[model samples]
Target chain A: MAQPHDRGPDFLERFVALLEGDDVFCVATVIRSDKPGMPAGSKAIFLRGGGVEEFGFGDPARTLRSQADRALDEGRPRIIALPEGVEVFLEVQRPPARLLICGAGHIALPLSRYAADAGFRVTVLDDRPEYASAARFPDADVVAEDFIPALHALAPRLFRHIVVITRGHAHDLDCLGEVLHWTTDYVGQIGSRRRLAFIKEELARRGFPADALRHRLYGPIGLDIGAESPEEIALAIAAELVCVRRLGAAHAFSLRGRSRAEAP
Target chain B: MTDLALARRLLQLRRDGLRVCLATVVEAAGSTPRDVGAKMLLCGDGATFGTIGGGCGEAVVRSAALRMLASGQGPGLVAVDLTQGPGERDGDVCGGRMRIFVDPG
Candidate 1:
């Protein structure tokens, strides 16, 4: 049921309160429209458990609800049609995307921190207790002192993204060998050009199909953003993850040089 | 997947006193990937968690989020129709109608 406009918090106030709630919710804003009543930038909120809280000055909630439902089911976002000239912007929300970084090394440190700051839930895994300490990855949602088995325990299907930046090529290969059959949204590895080639050859020798290996592997891992520092490289890797999800893995390689740090 | 996680994270961020905007699907129709009750969260600094629709739908909301964060005022209810544009005319054949609510959280 819709709340009365006068007594309840204005659309914005209620929207803010809803966003603050622990339950996941999606937000849709009318950025542009063909009609006059719905002004640009008007917004709404959709919840994960199949509910919604909306407060905006634009199109009636009824008109937008039809569109919102479709967006939620498709696991994507889309514009909605209302009447002849009205339009609404819909965005979806779910559990924070998780990244399973299977190594707690120098690279993992900054990558974990950056991923957390970038709004991803970071989890670290390493066989070394010294490197897996919470003190090292304070921002990580979890830090484990075991690599392959711990990763298996988490159930690879639940992981949204996976990044392998272990100590050396052998370790990376071992991790890949254990997890190749595990399903995940995205999988990537960090290594030098030569090391990447070596790992691929080794995997193929060990029976990993050349095609599957090629499709799953993202080596020298990250967008070619000319990233040098850990933070910069983290951004590139993050960018690649975003690209793979947004544009699909097939298009990720083609989006090699486009880096828009500008927000919006 | 990412959208839901992002929304939850946004909620956590607000515990520290930051303001945010949330979007969710209250209704949907036809052949679409997401269903009713999908959500996406938008933090004040352009940090977002979730998906409503990808591409233009997300981009438009991201732009709107900047204002929502800046104004400190919520716009209340918002909606978007996916079938209203040319690119979508040829591409998104999901034929499903959807409604979204954008508010400050």
Candidate 2:
């Protein structure tokens, strides 16, 4: 119930604080209005944590709230039309995607750097202290020594992308097992095609659902770029990660080898 | 410019006890130069940061912002229509409509 004038400091302070956090929010701005009241540039901040502040439109608070919620749900910026020739632009601000690399080995070294350059918050995890040292991964936001403990400590939802690039098949399987059930946007594992098949079969035999691996995993990860070196493979994986992040799995389709008639 | 950088400048200006006007493009139609949420900051000393497009529309907003900063009143919204008059000859024949809100702090 606090007015903008009475809570001026509070509004600016809260805005500065919100900008520092890693949660999504929407800023709704009334950009056009022909009728009286609530002129253009009137604004409101709708926080994902369930709060609205610095609201300008007095009579249409409910409508604005619902519109902001829809923008956040869609995770995109959009313009919503209100009654009486009023249009509000809802600008959704999403937190940067967090990438969890479950092995600070050769590929992860370049992968972390590439992911960071692509705007992801990179976190590297390895069982070996030498591999996970801060000196090795200067680009990573976090370098943790213990894989299982690091995975457990992480807020799974925050880490939208998880890549398992450990030293051996056993380590890859172990890393995948820790995060298989966690809600994530992308889960990729690096291995040969035959090794991926063996790992999937082994996972199926270990009480995981038969379709779980297929449904929730991207094995032999990275697009088919015919990558021969570690850096090239890292680039391929990074490209795939960017594709999945921006386009989503359902919309990301390879156009190679497809006839014009088969193109969507 | 990034929103954080603008916000930081706004905060600094406010903390310095100078009256400032923040103008933002809330609604853009047709072929406006800037998209929605584009911002411009105006200080009392004739200093400006960021921009909501340039030319006549910005000049009009700058005048209004100076007035609002002087008046110390609540925010004012101004609609800029560039579709009027002859194209190219008018110096602002972008053929777009923008609604800018000027909030004083």
Candidate 3:
């Protein structure tokens, strides 16, 4: 059997190659240490096929697999036992996140562009053929003429982030009524607090759970960046998304002083 | 090949008059296969040129191509709307969001 380093290039090299290839592979590194067998900067790779390859680590394959599997399973970074002076850091690569912008209004226009810039796969939907046209959102992956059917057409759990910026309250309700009950990662709508309240009341009147509605709905959708322009609003939404996705990378890189090392 | 290179090659292929579907991950908010601009190409016959999110995303692109092929023409642009999931506005729990564009060369 070939060792991770002996196999060919180090995990970092292969990791870069895989990322460049657009292949989903995991990166397992030493985030924290109790003892020392692997240093904090130590790393490994986990492919989706359940294979574990390491670079700059111990000879044991089971340990690498065990650690990588843990990270993949938890969807979080993991720390594994190495030697007395070393620890292992494990980061797994999953499929890219999906951003579903359900309205192709002015907000969707910028949101799609900025979201694409931030690295989220974006799909913009609206009932109006004109609003949802491709010309409006050249950066968006998909622009559709309808919403409800499109939402139902997707594979379950495929959309990780959803933004509702449809034309009016009725459309918002139509889109949210279906989406609110599903187990999506994030669901936000664009409107003032009062508008959302009226919408929520209508939804509740129709028997949607008020608590679930409260927890799932994010009105006035964006971080408070004092954004007034369409482009500025897009920036706020994009910034909020980064705040969510880079959580682990930020912590680990700060700890290791590799803040600029791993990022492109 | 790198996604950037693949994207360039795809554009080259497009210039060659081959209808190509270019798929790219423009945004990802959470644990996802690729980052912004991670791209892939899909030829008319289902020959892949690049990748966007990988895994299911690749699968989705394949289907999108078939749809394009069924329409039958030279390379053009087709956008895939993957925002809503089963009874959900946008599906998937990875919490990351992405957009994939399928286009002809």
True contacts kept of each: 0.03, 0.31, 0.03
Model 2 misplaced regions, further than 4 Å: A1-13, A19-22, A30-43, A48-50, A55-63, A73-88, A133-139, A251-264, B1-105
Please give, for residues A1-264, the per-residue lDDT of candidate 3 as tens digits.
323554445443455456444356656544334444544334567766566576655465455775566656777654455556454445445555678888787778888877876667678888788788878878666656567787787754677678887888898888888787677766776776677677778888877756655434555566666788878877876765665566633332233233222211
TM-score of predicted structure 3:
0.51
Model 2 chain A poorest 10 in a row by lDDT: A255-264
Tell me which of candidates 2 and 3 scores higher on TM-score: 2
Better of 1 and 3 by TM-score: 1
Q: By TM-score, how accurate is candidate 1?
A: 0.55
DockQ by candidate, in order? 0.07, 0.24, 0.03
Candidate with top TM-score is 2
Q: Which ranking of candidates, highest lDDT first?
A: 2, 1, 3
TM-score of 2: 0.63
Which regions of candidate 1 are displaced past 4 Å?
A: A1-68, A75-91, A255-264, B1-105
Of candidate 1 chain A, the 10-residue stretch with the lowest lDDT total is A255-264
Clashing pairs in 2: A31-B26, A31-B27
Q: What TM-score does model 1 score on chain A?
A: 0.66
lDDT of 2 by residue, B1-105 (tens): 546557778998999998888887867889888987788899988899988999889988999988887876667678898887665664678889998878785
Candidate 1 lDDT over residue span A23-71, tens digit each = 4455666644565665656556755544555555433764566567777
What's the lDDT of the predicted structure labeled candidate 3?
0.61
